[model samples]
Target: MTRFSFNQATANRWPIPDLVAGCVAAGVTRVGLWREQVADFGLEKTAALVKDAGLEVTSLCRGGFFQTPTWYEENSRAIAEAHTLGAPVLVLVSGGLPPGSRDVDAARRHVGEAIGRLVPATVEAGVQLAIEPLHPMFASDRCVVSTLGQALDLAAPYPAEAVGVVVDTYHVWWDDTVWAQIGRAGRERRIACFQAADWITPLPEGVLLGRGLPGAGCVELRRFREAVDAAGYTGPVEVEVFHADLWARPGAEILADTIAAYEAHVA
Candidate 1:
């Protein structure tokens, strides 16, 4: 099997300690974590749990959300948490437009600026700020950054080690320009994290928990993996699924199924 890192959101209800043990049992040495959950579990405790279990926190769940008034402070804490957890990358999910504002361009610009502001902290913490572009379906409510190209554009001004983009199959799979953008990300030395999740339909209420495991939906998982490989991304491939059904299962079972899907599809 390829080196797979299970994103904790796949089994959102799993306690951090249990998730660490589950990864060890599953032979998964890496994981992607969410900030909220990390805080809930106590950052230092979660860090120690993973370290003791010999697991690597591949990337922290998120550091962005430029629209919030407290974004700077929150992201600063996220950077510190990522460092404590030994995660080299901090995923940034640019929040949606300001309340009721339709000027998406302005929001995108603000996200870029916010990221630039965070570069100093990320660089000092030895963490790469990996910007994740959500699907267009979430443009107004989730993230304004909806394309890999746009994500890369935002990261253009920062050093690759300080700011890069996440090449997640779930978000960019529907874009015909994705392959090209992956190549562009590589050329610019800006590809930080590669996340895999299949694009499923029958959207959930918020359209955030409908992602399927690698092989469970219609996305071209192997194609995306191959493209990322071709683009010079020699990094851990993280399986990050967010589905109500998946989360309802036991954590171990969910992780096992996630591994099966990654092997059959992404690996």
Candidate 2:
């Protein structure tokens, strides 16, 4: 059975308690959270609440935005937070192009260096850093890790138990090399998270974040499933939609609809 989970990014405005409550109420078996919510609610309390509800936290929203100065401190803090939540994987969004740095290659190098420094801490905490490749559209402002291939390349140096890549359909559906990446990840045993969402045309308000449900758009999620399965990954196909319109509806309504959509399309 495909287990369902939602990224806290969907509930952009709701409190952490409310989001966890919503996930439980929605019958979602798993939940993923952002750093802000974790910090605001405090990690121990957040973990207790979710565990008390008997939910599996699929992964923590992130760590890693390789810039300078406080970058190391920030990454270490996120890794520690992941441990507190008991989340097996810590999703990492590599930082964007720094100012006065037209050299994307340089920015990428910085991301690589940062990951190297952070890997030890992640390993010590017994948390896997799941590198989440943002869409190419977000290459400038969000993450330089913009493709599964790129993310995998970064993961190559670390132990699979300590570092892996998050395969989110929303980010890689449009990539010409997705299948190859999936196959490689499965073969390498480096898949830590597998999430899904639809890709619609003309995009949406937060287009970089993704919009719609599985099979609701052009993403070949079944194909993605097939590839992942072939590579020997049987993890939950977490539903991480960031639709503004969906968020406007009641959380329960969204959850019910998401369950239906997962069954109809992803399963």
- Report, for every candidate in turn, its global Cα lDDT versus the true structure: 0.90, 0.82
Q: How many clashes (backbone N, Cα, C below 3 Å) per candidate?
A: 0, 0
Candidate 2 per-residue lDDT, tens place, 116-205, comes to 888889989999988899888888878888899999998898789988999988889878998988899998999999987888777766
**lDDT of candidate 1 vs native?**
0.90
Stretch of 10 with least lDDT, candidate 2: 1-10
TM-score of each: 0.97, 0.93
Taking the tens digit of each residue's C-alpha lDDT, what string does model 1 give over 150-170? 999999988988999999998
Give the runs in model 1 whose Cα sits over 4 Å from its true position. Answer: none
By TM-score, how accurate is candidate 2? Answer: 0.93
